[model samples]
Target: MSVNRRSILRTTAQLATLTAAGGLLTGCGQEAATGGGAAASEHPAHPSPTPGAPTVLTPNRIPAATPSAAVSGAPSAESAGASPSAPEQPPLAANTPAEVISGPSDRPQVALTFHGQGDPRLATALLTAAEQHGAKVTVLVVGSWLDQQPQMARRILDGGHELGNHTLNHLDISSLSADQAYAEIAGCADRIKALTGSIGRWFRPSAAQFATARVKAQARKAGYEHCLSYGLDPRDYADPGAEVIQRRMLGSIKPGSIVALHMGHQGTVDALPAVLEALQQRGLSAVTASQLCS
Candidate 1:
């Protein structure tokens, strides 16, 4: 077909594909710097898959950030109110060097990391499924999500899953200025620390799979020793069928690999069992990013 028509068809397909996510998705996302939707300067080899939220928590949760509160580049949310007591955490990631991508190739373990937002019920379902299969995953939550669903912070930890920060508003962190980026990182981190007795362990940049140097620096300032990235991406946030998610994961995942998934979709919840089963078949245990990296 003509180039114009092809472009139109592609756009239409993307729109059609997104229809099912109506009001369901909150958003999150990567593998390398290479391929999905982010600007080339943002991620080079693997483009990010889920590219908004950039927040799907909607405008209802809270202001993406309080501009004034964020100006000092300090976390203001910690003093908001009393937070729940957190459960004992899993073995934390002590490695302070390099980006956390995958684990040692010789080990039979892989990490499943989720961009956490969307319906709490769905998030719970996915977590339950993972736990049932004797798996543990990492959840990098958007700050605003916790504002709306504060209880989830404790619930995630209670389930033996490792919780991390995915920024306060889930914005395109790579595109933000230093102060703004710091606010995003520290903002959510403060919330995590307040709710869970710690800022969790890792920081995964929202809207992008990889963290830019600036983002890494900002995360360090916010108390993260290691930034988390992923080696495998099934694009579960795209609302692709559970089979597609399962197929993509089974086909691409490897030992010591970190797989990126999302918490807001039903397809992801449905795909959990089969994905876990496939991993079991391959003798790979699903673990947290800290577990894999450390």
Candidate 2:
């Protein structure tokens, strides 16, 4: 799961050169989920299961211009836009990975992240634990949730953790049209920008669902490199009990890990203290997703 700096530099150089050439290089790249090409020409494929862990899946590599055939419903915000007079949400600022602050690597470091609609109680618990432990955790807020819970969103920003965009209404990006997908992403960026006066740089598509090269390209164009998870995830989203959540997280966490847990889950909240304590005992310093990307 660890990609050395030389490899990262090489890939980054290639990506940068490609960007200068126009957009991303057009070609078919295999989807990790099905171990098959996710090109528009191929049929839709499911994400492949991680070795020895049903909950964890392999990381996806973004491809250029390879259109995916996936489909899904429209974002909730667009539907709400039936009234043109609706106030526009603030725009998100651009976040390029080159700007991120790198953290300690000689010592173990992991970023604990929460996904989904932000809940007040869950946010309180997450922020409180992080503050009490001096841990820096990344919170990927849904645009609708942020607009609904502005006060909570403000608290998250005030606390000094990096805020990332998690698309409006949690629609799967693979299912939306290119324009629709860009809107879903850009809308959130705009709203977040309106709130914090900065565009969002890190974007995590709902369900890690980037089915087409176009989807990934759209995200990059919006000033984000699709955030990829480093640590294998345990499915806390399904409401797996607290013990199970803790057990799964503790089982696979390692250095440079991007551990994922869901927000709005009571069980995860309950398990968090134990998880944080374990992280402390193991000397894994917590950080934001942005910090890890660089």
Q: How much lDDT does each candidate structure score?
A: 0.71, 0.57
TM-score of 1: 0.72
- Model 2's TM-score against the true structure: 0.63
Residues 1-294 of candidate 1: C-alpha lDDT, one tens digit per residue: 899999999999988878756534532211111101112212233233323423232223322332122222222334434354554544644553557777788889999988877778998999999999999998988766676667777778777889998887665787778667776777677667656667777888877878999989888887887788888888776677899999999998888888988886889999999889988988999987777766
lDDT digits (tens) for residues 51-153 of candidate 2: 1211211122222111221112112223333222222223322543322223335547787876745357776786777778788777776655655555555
- Report the C-alpha displacement of residue 173, candidate 1, in angstroms: 0.7
lDDT of 2: 0.57
Off by over 4 Å in 1: 1-96
lDDT of 1: 0.71
Clash number for each model: 12, 17
TM-score to native of every candidate shown: 0.72, 0.63
